[model samples]
Target: MAEITLVEAVNQALAREMSDNKNVLVLGEDVGIDGGVFRATAGLLDKFGDERVLDTPLSETLIGGVSIGMAAQGLIPVAEIQFMGFACSTIDQILNHAARIRNRTRGRLTCPMVLRAPFGGGIRAPEHHSESTEALFAHIPGLRVVIPSSPERAYGLLLASIRNPDPVVFLEPKRIYRLVKQEVPDNGEALPLDVCFIIRPGNDVTIVTWGAMTHDSLVAADKLAEQGISAEVIDVATLKPLDIETISVSVEKTGRCVIVHEAPLSGGWGAEISARLAEHNLFNLLAPIKRVTGYDTVMPLFRLEDQYMPSTDRIVGAVNEVLKFE
Candidate 1:
């Protein structure tokens, strides 16, 4: 095992998958010779050659459509959209076609494709490069929305996404792409999808989050620990088809919950988790569920990015508020 950044782990997974399975191919703008805008696909072209590592035109719609066609025809296509903000053009193909193919064909065909995009704010990126609208895709049926928080999860989950028999939206938190390093094995093994990973265990409160927010939640958990607050931190790696059982069980133990995310508060996935808790574990709550999320507004420019995203302070504050009830 070698220590690597989240983005490097992603590149390793892609390389391993493409090497292990001839059916897996990478296609996207600047993915080949240029090795991708962020170099997540770096060195792939040299290892896999031009045939497997294709550089498509600068049209996300075309990329989405071609990927759908390839997946329906038995190829496992891993298409990359430079940024989540630019993926709007590919929504038609993803929602209407790629996602609905299997159900529409009544099992005659399956769309085994992974749409990769770097999402979230930070890195001083301009507009159209720092969006975190994952909930939009999570709302769509027949799609698995997966986000990785750490290098190990990035490596394992990405491999699982590519091998999934259905279409998946693999969102990478660019904010933490190189923020931290962790040891990840290059064993070609895939982690289970639609599951949550508990980062820290405690009995005081459950803090649920994913992507870049997970880092802040962990930090807040540690800080709260110093103040005698035992916070249980959970990384909801798979946003869609959420592993509600894990979350509900944790909340049931703590009897308090705080949901966090970088996406705006309105209609974010945090609300979905809250709803699940309210429905299934209403009696388990010792306090009202609190949400520490970004404001319900457009992600601001880099200058105010910190104010817009949920921070360690915000998470700890939310936990304090919930703890107050008891």
Candidate 2:
């Protein structure tokens, strides 16, 4: 095992995959010579040559559109959008083509493309750079969405997404890319795509979250332990086909929940989790399920961003509120 940053792990994964599979290719802005803005693909171009590591023009639509075409023709395309926010510009192509080609062509065509996007805030980036748009992509029918909180998971899941026979949106949490380091093997072994991991075991309250918020939940859970509260922290690694069973099982035991995220509260992914919890197992709710998330407003600039995102105090407060009924 080796301790590596998330960025380095991803860079390793790309290099390893390209070495093993000649058909695997990467394309995105500044990906060739300059590497990515985050340096996730820093040395890939030097190793694989321009054909496999391409630097496309500043056009996300073309990136998404051409990726679908390349994948349909049997080349495994690992396309990157500089930021998660930038990918929104190509929603038309993603939803209309990359997402629907398998069913649209009645199995004659398969678009096995991985759309990599660096997302989330806390680095004080410009507007739209920190937005968590997983909910929007989850709403799409055929696209698979995955987020990795640790360096190891990032490498493994990304490799899995590239090999899977469907379009996947892999959201790499930029905040923890280099800040959070973990011991990951050099080989990019893939993870099972349809399940969540229980990072911490507990029986009091379940904290459901992903991406950057996973770290927030971990911090909050640690603090809650001081107050004699056991909050089970479950990471929804695969956001699209959510591991509903694992989540429900934890809630079934804990009997209380606090769905958290960096995105705004109203239509955020937390809302969907809460709705499903309320509908399927009302009796298990010890208190009304709580949600600590961003406000229902545009992601503000760095100055006021703190007020827009969830915090440890808010999570602690929610857990305290649930405990009051006990």
Candidate 3:
């Protein structure tokens, strides 16, 4: 076991997968030679060689289409978009073709491809580099959207995504990419997809969050504990095919809930979680579900980025507001 950052864990997963499965190939802008914009694919080219680790032109549309073609032909391609913002150009290929291949072919074919991108704010990136619009992908019918908040989860979830027999949108939260380190075994074990990870348990309030926001949620939970408020924290690892049952169980016990995310307040994945809880677990609630999230506007530039993202105080405030109801 080795203690590594989230980005390093991602590299380890890619290397292990490429080693175990010869059909597993990696391609994207600078993924091979430059080792990805964040180096999540570092040292892969030397190990897998030019044939398997490819560096394509700066065209996300081409990368998405090529990955679909390769997957259809039996190659499990792991394509990278430099940033989530750049992924917008590939929406057509991902939604119209890659995501629909299995259904269109009536199980005659499957598209086993993983699209990876660094998302969210906190590193002072310029325009088109700090997007966290995961809701857009989660809304798509056939694609799975996965986000990991820690090194261990990043390793396991990425392995699961690559091995899955369907197209997956793997969003890497770059904000916490190097924020923490944890011991991760390189045994190539894949964590189960479509499940929420209960990071902490409490009886007062359930704080549901994902991606970089999970960090803030955990911090807020600790702050609440100091103030005599017990809070459970859950990381929604897989946004699409959500594990609402886990969330429902938590809410049933705590009788209060607060959903948080770095994405905009409107139409974010948090809304979906709130809706499911209201539909299936309304009677179990002790307070109205609250949301602590970014504004319903574009992610501000570096100077004002922190203001736009939800803070630990904001999460605690939301908890306080929900707690007041009961």
Candidate 4:
């Protein structure tokens, strides 16, 4: 295992998958010569050349549309939208076509493709550059949504997504792209989907989260210890087919739950989680599940953006509220 950044892990996964599968192809705006917006695709184009690692026009609608056609025809096409917000442009293709392709074909044709995007705020990127849109994709019947919290999980899950027969929306946490680092397996790592990682083990409260919010959740857990609360932080690697068993175990032990995310409070993934907890463990609950999430407003511009993103203070406050219920 070697210490690496999220960007490095993503590049390594792409490189290894392409080497193993001749049919694996990558395409997106600035992906080929420019190495992608975050350089996650850097050096891939040079290795695979223009045909395999393509740089398409700046039209997400066409990118998803074309990738669907390629995947249906047997090419494992991985299309990257510039950002999660830009992915909205491809909804027509994704919702009406890519997602429904295999079902529409009744198992004859498969949309075994991966839609990749860097999502969520924290690097002070421009508006529309960071959005946690995973829930939207998860709500689609035939689509799989995944968001890896660290370098190792990123590499493992990317490989899994590429190998899956169904369509996948792979969301990378943009905030920790270059900011966080960890030791990642060089190769030969196959992490299964539908599993959750207990990033930190504790007994007081369970903090469930994914993407960049996982990093903040851990920091908040550490602070909570200073205040005499032992918080368990669960880093969710897959968004769809959520590891409810793992979450239920932690929540059952802790008797309190605080969910964290960068998306707005309304209609976000947190709502789904909260509903699940209420359904599975309401009798075991010591406190009503709380959420530390973005404001119920648009992704704010630079000026007051800090107010729109989740922070350690916000997370701890939510946890404290749950703690009081105990």
Prediction 3 global C-alpha lDDT: 0.95
- For model 2, residues 1-326, the per-residue Cα lDDT tens digits are 66999888888888889999999999999999988999988999889999999999999999999999999999999998999899988889899999999999999999999999999888899987998888999889998999988888888888888889999989999989888888888766888897898999998999999998888899999999998998899999998888888999999999998899998888888888998888876987778889999888889998988878888889899889987876
- Candidate 2, number of clashes: 0
Clashes of 3: 0
Mark the regions of model 4 whose C-alpha exceeds 4 Å error after superposition.
none
> Across residues 1-326, which tens digit of lDDT does each residue of candidate 1 receive?
66899999999999999999999999999999899999999999999999889999889999999998899899999999999999999999999999999999998988999999999999998888998999999999999999999999999999999999999999999989999999898999899999999999999999999999999999999999999999999999999989999999999899999999999998999999999999988998999999998898888999999999998999999999999996
Residue pairs of candidate 1 with colliding backbone atoms? none
Q: Give the TM-scores of the predictions, in the order they appear.
A: 0.99, 0.98, 0.99, 0.97
Where model 2 places Cα greater than 4 Å from the true spot, the runs are none
Task: Write model 3 residue lDDT over 1-326, tens digit each, in one string.
Answer: 66999999999999999999999999999998889889998999999999999999889999999999899999999999999999999999999999999999998888999999999999998898998989999999999999999999999999999999999999999999999999999999999999999999999999999999999999999999999999999999999999999999999999999999999988999999999999988898999999999999989998999899999999999999999985
The true-versus-predicted C-alpha distance at residue 103 of model 4, in Å, is 1.2
Model 4 agreement with the true structure over 202-247: per-residue lDDT tens digits: 9999999999889889999989999988999998788787878899
lDDT of each: 0.95, 0.90, 0.95, 0.89
